[model samples]
Target: MAEIDHIVLGARSLEEGAAFVERHLGIRPRPGGQHLGFGTHNMLLGLGRGVYLEVIAPDPAQPDPPRARPFDLDDPALRQALEAEPRLIAWVARTPVLEAVIARLGHRGGEVVAMTRGDLSWRMAFPPQRQDMDNLIPALIQWQGEGASSRLPDSHARLLQLEGEHPEVDAVRAALAERGLEEALKLRPGPHARLVARLRRADGVEVALASG
Candidate 1:
């Protein structure tokens, strides 16, 4: 069965992204390394169990990527949207048999791309055109080893739920079911595409992180 590996929060800059987490969750995220080819870097916050939160932004120190950056970071509209606030942009699901799952889903997930960050590496399957399925669909990942979640420090935040909002909730649910993730995520009909995650802090405060 597939499981959620991480949730992605996108920002115009890493500084801005980290600040958003600190301001809302009352915790700072640990530094994560850069994606060399992708020209991006991230900060990580462990959300208990094997799930984590990733704050990602383009690395100003790096040259422009050869192709468009992942998660539509290069898109002007998305960049403008992120200027207002850091938002939940994407999520990843881990599967051992990535190829079989891709085949089973009839190729909704794109070709597998090998990605590395320092000593960590994984195979990621992005969706076709990168925006199909209203961006409600999750990218698929196959970790090379134990994965980064095990090495992260606990951020004292417990992920209570992760859900999706879309106009076509039934179709999204069916796709998740095909990937064996229907039980892991709940989809509800809404006017737009969005991700909503509820996290409980150590002090008994619950916060909802939503893409808006």
Candidate 2:
């Protein structure tokens, strides 16, 4: 069965996003390398167990690529949204047999692209267009070797639950159900698409991370 892998937080800059996690969640994420072709980079924080948090942003050091960046960072609306602060933009579901899952879903999930960051590598099924499904549905992932969560230092923050709001709640639920992930993700009818993550700190304090 597919399982929640990680949540993606988008920011204008990696420094800003990492700072937000440290200040608000009381955890400092470790440096994750650049996405060569995508012109983006990330910082990662372990959410305990096999789940983690990924804060991604544009890599200023890299020259603009021919193609648009992932997570719809190049979109004007998304840029405006991030002007104030970083926001939860997407999430990933992990499955051992990614191809099978994609086939079962009739390829609505996206295309599987092999990606690498330093020693870490994985295959991600991204939507045809960056905003095709966006926050309404999750991308599929299959780790090439060991998952990043296993190597990350525990940040003392545990993921409680993940929920979302989408105008097409029924379609989203259907997709998740097809992937056998319906029970792991909760969706409600709403005007716009948004993802919410609930987490608890070691001190027993709970915090919610939402997409704006």
**Cα lDDT tens digits for candidate 2, 97-169:** 9988777766576777888888889998876663344565777889999998999988889989999888888
Candidate 2 residues lying further than 4 Å off, grouped into runs, are 130-133
- Candidate 1 C-alpha lDDT tens digits along 50-153: 99999999999899999789888888988999989998888889999998887776667687889999999999888876445656788899999988899998
Clashing pairs in 1: none
Estimated TM-score per prediction? 0.96, 0.94
In terms of lDDT, the best-performing candidate is 1
Q: What is the TM-score (0 to 1) of candidate 1?
A: 0.96
- Candidates' lDDT values, in order? 0.87, 0.85
Instruction: Please identify model 1 stretches exceeding 4 Å from their true place.
Output: none
